[model samples]
Target: MLNSKLLHKKLFLDSGLKTQVKEVNTSNLEWTKNFGDIAPFMQLDLRLIWRNKRTKSSVWMLALGLLYGLFFYPNPTYNNMPFFFIFIGIFSTGIFLINFGQFVPAWDSGYYKLLMSQNIKYEQYLKSKFTLMALSVVILFVLGIPYVYFGWKILLAHFAAAIYNIGINTHVILWGGSFNRKKIDLSQKAAFNYQGTGAVQWLIGIPLLVLPMIIFALFNWLLSFEIACLVLTVMGVVGIVFHQKLMRFITGKYLESKYKMIDAFNQDN
Candidate 1:
C-alpha cells in the first residue's frame, strides 16, 4: 500500500500536474497584479467601449449634441429660455450616461461571473465606469462650444448642466445600475435597441433631468433666471463635495445586490 501510494505520487509528478498547477497559480498571480490596478482596468474598459459597435454610436449622439443648438437657435420659442439651454446641456452631455450607463454590470453579463470570480475589487470596476462617464461629460461639453453662438448664457447653462451631470446624475445613474439585471449585447446597434432597459432606467430620467428642471423653473418663476442657475450650480457643487460619500453608499448597494445581479445575469432572458 505504501509503495502504491508512492507510485501514484510519482505518476502525478511525471504527468506534469504539479507543474501545471504551479503555472496556473503563477498566471493567476500575474493577472491579479495587472488587472488589480485601476489604470489597467480603466484602460481595458475604455478599449472595450471603443471596440464595441453599440458604444461607438455615442459618437453620432455626440455630434448631434454639438449641433443641438441648431434646432433651438432657429426656433424663437426656445432660443431665449434659460431652461431650454439647461435641458439641452443635460441631454447632450448625458448621452453616454443615459445610453451606456443603464446597463451597468449587465453590459458584462456574458463574462460577469468570470470577472466576479477573479480577485477583482468591485470599487475598481465601478470606478472605471464612473471615470468613463465623467470623461464623456467633458468631451460632450467641449464639443458643445459652438452653442456659444446662441449666447454666452447658453454656454454657461451648458457648463452648469455639465457640472450637475458630473456631480449628480452620474452617481444617480450608477446607483440605478445596481438594479440592472437584464443583459446587454454590445454587438447590437444602438438605434432603437433597448435590450437591457427596464422601468428603473425609464424612471431614472425623472430625477436626473426633470427634478432639476422643475426646481429651476420654480425658482426662476419665484426669483430670477440667474438665481435658478445658481441654485442648480449650488446643488451640483454640493453633490460634488459629497461625491466620495455617495460612492461609498452606492458601492454598498452594489455589494448588497452583487449575488442577485449574478443570478439575474445567469438567467436566459
Candidate 2:
C-alpha cells in the first residue's frame, strides 16, 4: 500500500540510518539525496545568521544595495558613463554573497569545534553555504527586474551581474574565506562593526567585485556594451559549469585550514 521508495525512506528515518543509508547496487547514491542528508545544516545556518544581531541587520545593506541605482539612474552625469551600471549590478545582486560569505567558517567560530565534531562532510557543509548564496543572488536579481524601467541595458547589466555572482563570486568568496578565519562577536551592534574583518576580506573584493568591473570596462571599450555583457555572462556560465570542481577545491582548502581556523577561533574564547 505504501509507495516502495517512500517506505524505504520511512524505514531509514525510523531506523536512524537516514544519513548512512546507501543505494542498493550503486557505490554512490544521487547527489540530491546525499545533499538532503546535510540539508539541516542549511536550516541551522539560517538560524545562526538570524541569531546574530549584526548579520541580521545586514538586511539594511541589501535595501541600500537595491536603491543604490537611484543615484546613477536619475543623474545625467551617469548617462554617458554606462560602465558604472556594472558596479551597481554586482553590488545589488551579490550584496549577500559578499557580506556573508567572506566570513565563511568564521561565522561559526562560536561553535566551530562542535561543528567540526559532527559527521557532516566538509563538501556538504560548503554546499549548504553555496546554495544559500546562490539563492540570494537569484532573489536579488528577480527583485531587480524593475530596474528594466531605466533601460534594457540596465536589465542586461544586472542579469550579467547576477549570473556572475551566482557562478563566480560565490565560489570566490568561499575560497577566499579559507584563509584568515577571524572571530566574530555576534552579540555586538551591526553598525560599523569590524569584528571579523581582516586583510583577506578587503583583498577579496578585488576579484569578487573589481575584477568583473574591469573586465566589463575593457570589453565595453574594445568592442561594445552588449559584447561586454555577453563576456561577463560567459565567464559566469563557465564558472557555473565547473561549480562542482570548484566546490571540491574549496572544500579541500577548508579541510587544510580547519585546524588553523579552530585554533584561531579559540584565541578569543
Candidate 3:
C-alpha cells in the first residue's frame, strides 16, 4: 500500500512539471511573437533617427529645448509673466514633435514608394509616428520635472503644455504632414538644413505653438493663472480621450494625400 501511494505521488509530480514547462514555453513564444511583430518598425525608427544627420539633429534640439528654462527661469524680469511661461512650456515640451513630425513620411522620401509597396498598413505607419511624438512629450515632460525648483507654477505650466502637446499637437502635426508633403534628403548636413521646409511647416506652427498660448492667454486674462492652466490641461485631456478617433481621421488624411505625396516626392528624386 505504501509503495502504491509513492508511485501515485511520483505520477502527480511529473504531470505538474510537464504542465509548468508547457506554460513557460507558451509565455516565451507569445513574447517572441510580439517582439517579432514590432521589431521592424522599431528598427526603422531607430535607423531614421541615427542614420540621418538631419533627423539626429533633433536630439540636440531636444537637449537645447530642455535647458531653455535655465535662460528664462533665472531672470527676475520674466517672473510673474504667466503667458511667457506658457510659451516656454509649449516650446520646450513640444519642440521635437514640431521639428520631427512636420516632415512625416517625407523623412522616408528616398524609399517612400518602396515603403508603401510593403504590406504595412497606412494607419500603422501614421500611428508609429504618432507614438514617437507622444513618447517625446512624455519624456520631455519627465525631464523637465527639475524645473519645479524654479517654481511650482512653472512646473504646472509645463505639465499642461506637455499634456496639450501629447494630445493635440501630435495629431495636428501628423495631419499637417499629410498636406504639402515634401521629400527630405537624408544626406543633407544637419546644420541649417531646411531641405524639406515648405509653407506647411511655417503655417502649422501657428496652431501647434501659437494657438495654445492664445487659448491660455485668454483664460489667464479673463480669470487667473491657475484657471488658465486648468483649462489648457482639460483641453489636452479631451484630445487624449478621443485619441483613436483623431488617429483614424489623420490616417484618412494621409490616405487621401497618398498619390499627391507620391508625385511630389518623386519630383525631388
Best by TM-score: 2
What TM-score should be assigned to candidate 1? Answer: 0.83
lDDT of 3 by residue, 106-187 (tens): 8888888788888688877777777778888899989999999989999999999999998889988988989866788987
Model 2, which residues run further than 4 Å from truth?
1-35
Best by lDDT: 2
Model 2 per-residue lDDT tens digits across residues 1-269: 46987877667554665345543323332333445855777767776777679778656577877788987898778777768889999999988888888888788888898889885699989988899889888988898899898889999999999999988999999999899668988888888788889999999999988899999999999999999999999999999999999999999998999899989998873
Candidate 1 or 2, higher TM-score?
2
Error of 2 at 189 (Å): 1.1
My TM-score estimates for the predictions, one after another, are: 0.83, 0.85, 0.85
Any runs in candidate 1 off by more than 4 Å, and if so which? 1-36
- Give lDDT tens digits, candidate 1, residues 1-269: 99999988777554688788887764342442454456666666665677787767765666776676777766778855777778888888888777777778787888888888996888878877887788889998898887787677888888888888888988999999999888778898888987777888888889888988888788888998778888888888898899889989999999999999989888877
- Flag regions of model 3 displaced more than 4 Å: 1-39
Give the local distance difference test score of model 1: 0.80
Model 1: colliding residue pairs: none
Report the Cα lDDT for candidate 3. Answer: 0.85
- By summed lDDT, the worst window of 10 consecutive residues in model 1 runs over 26-35
- Worst window of 10 by summed lDDT in candidate 2: 23-32
